[model samples]
Target: MTYQESHFFIWIAAAYLLGSVPTGLLLGKLYGIDVRRQGSGNIGATNLYRTVGRKVGVMTLVGDCLKGIAPVLLARQFGLSGEQIAWIGLAAFCGHVFSIFLKFKGGKGVATALGVFLALSPLAVLVALILFVLLMLKWRYVSLGSVCAAAVMPLAVALLSGGRTLTLVTFLIGLIVIVRHLENIRRLLAGTENKFKA
Candidate 1:
């Protein structure tokens, strides 16, 4: 295959690998505690923060976010089409949600999803951030706010893009985000979910 043709597979694989880095696991290992075995028994930034401390949690969040951003940005450097970019975003999201290194079990993909959308559509990201803050502050529930923010992403992209490929991609990403939070939703419904502290 030509170099241009080969970029399709190369980009997807690279993005997936980037997404599968497992920032939470690395942070937990750094602290000598398996974060998955601790609070929430999940390998996400929130659990990492609850298990370790603010510093480690912050680092994990940054790493996870960067993973999504980096791959898509790199793909853009190759002058890919909008559809290709959307595919890159999807692959990256899947990698984060089902990382290969983590036995195909990974985080809820909120932060990583945000990273992809943030880089691909900054305006949508800004709107989602605003919604996230409003919901979180009004309800004092991070998961609720996060889910609402994710749900708004596709709408925001639609408003910004006029139903382009990015719109559909954002919608799919938003749905994936919600699906990843199913456990949190169950906990929230049962009133057993813990809220984040200031």
Candidate 2:
């Protein structure tokens, strides 16, 4: 393999390791709390916010977002093509969804996926963010907004960038996010899903 080819695995490995850092759980541990047991048994930002605090939750969001953005940007800066960057992003997203350190259990990959798409197609990500915010404002259900925004991500990426590979990556990210929200879907159906409080 060429030098660049050899470094591909390095970048991917680095991304996965960085993404696998369970920011929420670590933060909760710092405060002597098991956030997973407190709220929704999730290690994502939302669960952190609900169980920990807004500050810790924001920190987790930033940390998780960086995990997604750092590797893809680094790969791109090293002159990797769109497809390679996409793979790097996917590796990071997968790390979040199935964290190695968490014994293959982790967050829903929402913030990490946000960071990935922000680096891949910022405009598309911005549009999806707007959709997510609007939905959240209207329904107060972060899960519903996440599911719908993920569902819209591929269309946004396609329309804004016309990137076949990026669209494919976004679609897969969306699918994983939706699947992760299956429990929320069940709760929504049963009218037992929690709503965000002002």
Candidate 3:
């Protein structure tokens, strides 16, 4: 590969590694627990809150969100093109979805994707966040709310930014988030999905 390609891959790898930090898992350990072994068995903030405490949950959320933001921002600072920035964001989201440190297991990519979108298309992310909050408040189901927001994110990005690259990245992130929620989907269908306990 040429030097440019190598540099591109390096940034992508860095982004993936940043996303693979397992913020929730590490936070759980600080409290002497394994987040992946408790509650919904997810390493995301919701599971952390349910298994640990609100503070730890919020901390993990911030850490994970930063994981998403840092990589894309750093790539942008490096003068990468918009397409490269989008790819880096997607790589970070993929890393959160399939963490190397977790033996290729990881959390659903909602929060991390949100962070990426925050950099790529702030207004679209804002709309999606509002939708998420409204859905959660109306239905008391975090998973449902996340899924709904994710469902709308691709169109939001497309319409708001008119950036095909970012829109494609958003669609992929949303698809991955939905796939990661397969068990939750089944539970929802059976009317057995756990409502947000907050």
Candidate 4:
């Protein structure tokens, strides 16, 4: 393979590895808590915040966000194309969702996808964030907000970035987020999902 092709693979691998770091799980361990065995049994920031403490949860959120942002920024610094960067972002998101370090299981990929889209299309991310906040304020269901924001991301990217590759990647990431929240959706439908307490 050419040098560029080799570098692409290297970046993809690095992104995946970075994304698979399991930030919440690691933070929980530092506090003598196994996030996977607590709360909703999720290693995402929300679960960390719920089971651990707000500090650890915020730390996990920042760490996971960096998992998405770092690689995309590095790829851009290395002069990779937008399409290539999108794929790298997707790789990071996938690693979070299907973490190799966690027996191929992981969190719902919301914050990581937020980071990815923040890099790829900040306007889209802003729009989605607003929708998320609105939904959360109105319904108090984090999962519902996440699912709704994710469902809107593709359209937001399509309208703002106007790039087919970015839109497609965003669509895939959003789809995965919704899929990962399937249980939450069921609970929301049944009025059994927990609401965020602030």
Candidate 5:
């Protein structure tokens, strides 16, 4: 293919690599515990909080968010268009959801999804953040907050981002987050889901 095609492939590869960093796993290993084997058996921030402590959980949260933001920023630096940038953002989200090193078992993709949305549509992020805070305040449940945030993400993006490609990308991202949280929803309905502790 042409040079542009090759460059696009390279950028996507880079984005995937960024997404595959496994921040939770790395932090868990540092603390001498396999995060996947502990607590809820999830390598996400919630599990980190239950298995380890708030410090490590916050670290995982920041790292996961950065993985999403970094690659999209790099793609922009490469001078990719809005449409072309969507691919890289999607790759980053996919990497977080299906990390190669995690045996394909990954987090709920909420944090990573936020990273991409933050890069592509800042206003959408602000709107989702407000909704997330309000929902979590009322329910005191992270999973419910995450589910509501994901559900609102698409509408937020559609309203904040007028382009079809960006809107579609945001919709898919939100869908993925919601689908990943299916178990959480079930637990919420059953009143068995764990809540965030101070």
Candidate 6:
């Protein structure tokens, strides 16, 4: 392959590897908890918070978000094209959703996707965040908020940034997020989903 092609693949691989880090699982281990075996059986921040502690959950959130941000920033620093960077962001989100380290199992890509869009288009992220917050405040269901925010992201990106590649990637990431929350959606519909506290 040519140098540019090779460089791009390397970055894609790196971003995926970074995204697959399983922040909640590692943090849970540090505290002698295996988050995957705990509440909701999820390695995402919400499960971490409910199963572990608030601090660990928050840490996981930041770490997963960074996994999304770092790769995009590095791609930009390396002078990658916007389309290439969009792909890299998607790679990062995919990693979190299908982590190699976790035998291809991973968490919902909410926080990580947030990081990606925050890097690609802060305005879109802002709009999504407002939606998330409003839903959270009104319904107290984290899953509902996440699903709704993710559902809104593609349109937000298209309208605010006008980057077709970025919008498509965001749409895919948002779709994945919604898919990963299928169980939660069922629970929400059944009125049995856990509500976030404080």
lDDT assessment of candidate 6:
0.94
**Model 6 pairs in collision:** none
- By TM-score, the candidates rank as 6, 4, 3, 5, 2, 1
Predicted structure 2, TM vs. truth: 0.96
**Tens-digit lDDT string for candidate 1 (47-149):** 8888898888888889889988988888788788878888898888889889999889888888899889878989989999998998888877878988998
lDDT of 3 by residue, 79-126 (tens): 999999999999999898899998989999888987898888999988
Q: How accurate is candidate 2 locally (lDDT)?
A: 0.91
* Model 2 clashing residue pairs (backbone): none
Model 2, residue 102: distance off in Å is 1.1
State each model's CA lDDT, in order.
0.86, 0.91, 0.90, 0.93, 0.87, 0.94
Residue 75 error, candidate 1, Å? 1.4
Candidate 6 residue 155 C-alpha distance from true site, Å: 0.3
Clash totals, every prediction: 0, 0, 0, 0, 0, 0
Best model number under lDDT: 6
In angstroms, give how far residue 113 of model 5 lies from its true place. Answer: 0.9
RMSD of each: 1.4, 1.1, 0.9, 0.7, 1.0, 0.7
Candidate 1, number of clashes: 0
- Candidate 5, residues 1-198, lDDT tens digits: the string is 999999889888888878887899899999899988898788888899888999999889989998888888888887898887987898888888889877776888888888898999999899999989998888789988888888888888888787888888888888889899888899999999887777
Encode model 4's per-residue lDDT on 36-123: one tens digit a residue.
Answer: 8899999999999888988998999999999999899999999999999999999999999999999889999999998898899999
**lDDT score of model 1?**
0.86
Can you tell me which runs of candidate 4 are displaced by over 4 Å?
Answer: none
| Model 1 spans > 4 angstroms off | 1-3
